[model samples]
Target chain A: MTLEAGTTLPTQTFVVRRADLVRYAGASGDLNPIHWSDRVAMAVGLPGVIAHGMYTLALAARAVATWTDDAEVLELGAKFTAPVVVPDDDTGVSVEVAGEVASVEDGRATLRLTVTSEGQKVLGMPKAVVRA
Target chain B: MPVDASLVGRTYPPTRPYPVSEAKVRELAATTGADWDGGPVPPTFPILLAFEAMNAFLEAEGVELARIVHGDQKFRYERPLRVGDVLTAALTVASVRSIGGNDVIGTTSEVRDADGALVCATSATLVHRGGAA
Candidate 1:
């Protein structure tokens, strides 16, 4: 993929359900109850069961891989600005990831990503640097 | 409870070595709806090691996992992680501050290979919610 400055990559949407959170907890070893148990999440002042921050970030990484054909990721980072509440339903919620090539220099492409769920931005300053 | 300010700059011991296997890589990828074709592991794959270090730190400090929420995370890679790489993460408390009765703790973990070569540097911010006043 030829990434140039100002190029917008295709947007990707991921459906996050309660089952996915359980799978992620096992896979990543997070096991934070807020990510699975609605009772614990509510006790901690969360609206309901929330997705793991790393899981949401992983969706962004998936978008990067799709855009770059799994290019060598030199850097990836993001701030968890808001909680993505995953309801206990089959359909779940949709998290959308969109990116634009901020710059490309020295064989690297810097991407600025916007991740959103429930029409609210979920990640702050999500960005990735990949070997082009 | 707020994290102790004195904890800043304190580095914890390196975590146990984690062997990167293809099954592990595939498992993480599947969570994100991706299929691992045995190429470079996903960019955020090192979080498994970092999270383990954080868990150890929290356990030692008597912090409850249910009271904490993730605030931020960042990863800078020296090279792509591949299968068969055994890695460990050494964590350091970077900063601590209180905001609106919540303790925001900052930590940075260095992910190193078996040779102790830095493979990635990952930083995370954890927000510990205070009990009712």
Candidate 2:
């Protein structure tokens, strides 16, 4: 596939639930209570138990990998603009990721990504460069 | 106290090598909901090493894990990390700032192969609430 600038990759959304966070915490060894305990998260001034930033980042990573058909030599970056609050319900928050090729050069393609949850952007300055 | 700005630019010694095995990567994949066929690499997988390095950095700086909020994360790779490649990580504080009684610290972790070749660099920002309150 020839990726040119302004090519919009198919968008994807990922669900982040409490159970998913538990698995991520166990796998990533990031046992921060804000990801699991509502009381702690509230005490810390968050809306509620929130998803881990890395988890959200991973979702974006998946999008980039899917677009390029490879994950190697991919540079991914994002600033946490807001937390994706996961309520205690079975219907967890859905994170939407949309990417477009901003540029292609030297056999590399740079993708600009927008990540949103609940109609609010959660990741700022999101960008991914893949050696497609 | 605010994270000492002087800490910026100080790189810790490389940690002992960690063997990356298929089982370990698979375990991480199962946890993160990713399937592993061992092609290319998972973009966020290098964070496994970076997270370990961050732990050592927090310990050495006397920072409490419970007080931290990850604010940002970035990964730049020289190559894909494959199974069986033992790796080490060294962290360097990149910046520090204080806001509303919170200490925002920027850190960069360098992941190197057993031969000391750079494999990837993960940068992160950690916000510590009431650290200077």
Best by TM-score: 1
Q: Give each prediction's DockQ, rounded to 2 decimals.
A: 0.93, 0.70
Counting clashing residue pairs in each candidate, in order, gives 0, 0
Query: Where does candidate 1 stray beyond 4 Å?
Result: none
For this target, which candidate reaches the highest DockQ against the unseen true structure?
1
Predicted candidate 2 versus true structure: per-residue lDDT over A1-132, tens digit per residue: 567899998989888889999888888888889999999888877889999888898888877777777635568889998999999889998999998999989978889999999999999989988885
Local lDDT at B75 for model 1: 99
Query: TM-score of each candidate?
Result: 0.98, 0.94
Candidate 2 on B17-129: residue-level lDDT in tens?
A: 99988877777766546687776557687788888888888888887776788999999988888888899999999999988878899999999998889999889999988
The number of clashing residue pairs in model 2 is 0
Q: How does chain A of every candidate compare to the true chain A by TM-score?
A: 0.98, 0.95
DockQ category of candidate 1: high
lDDT string, candidate 1, A1-132, tens digits = 789999999889999999999999999999999999999999889999999999999999999998998899999999999999999999999999999999999999999999999899999999999998
Q: After superposition, how far is residue A111 of candidate 2 from its true place, in Å?
A: 0.6
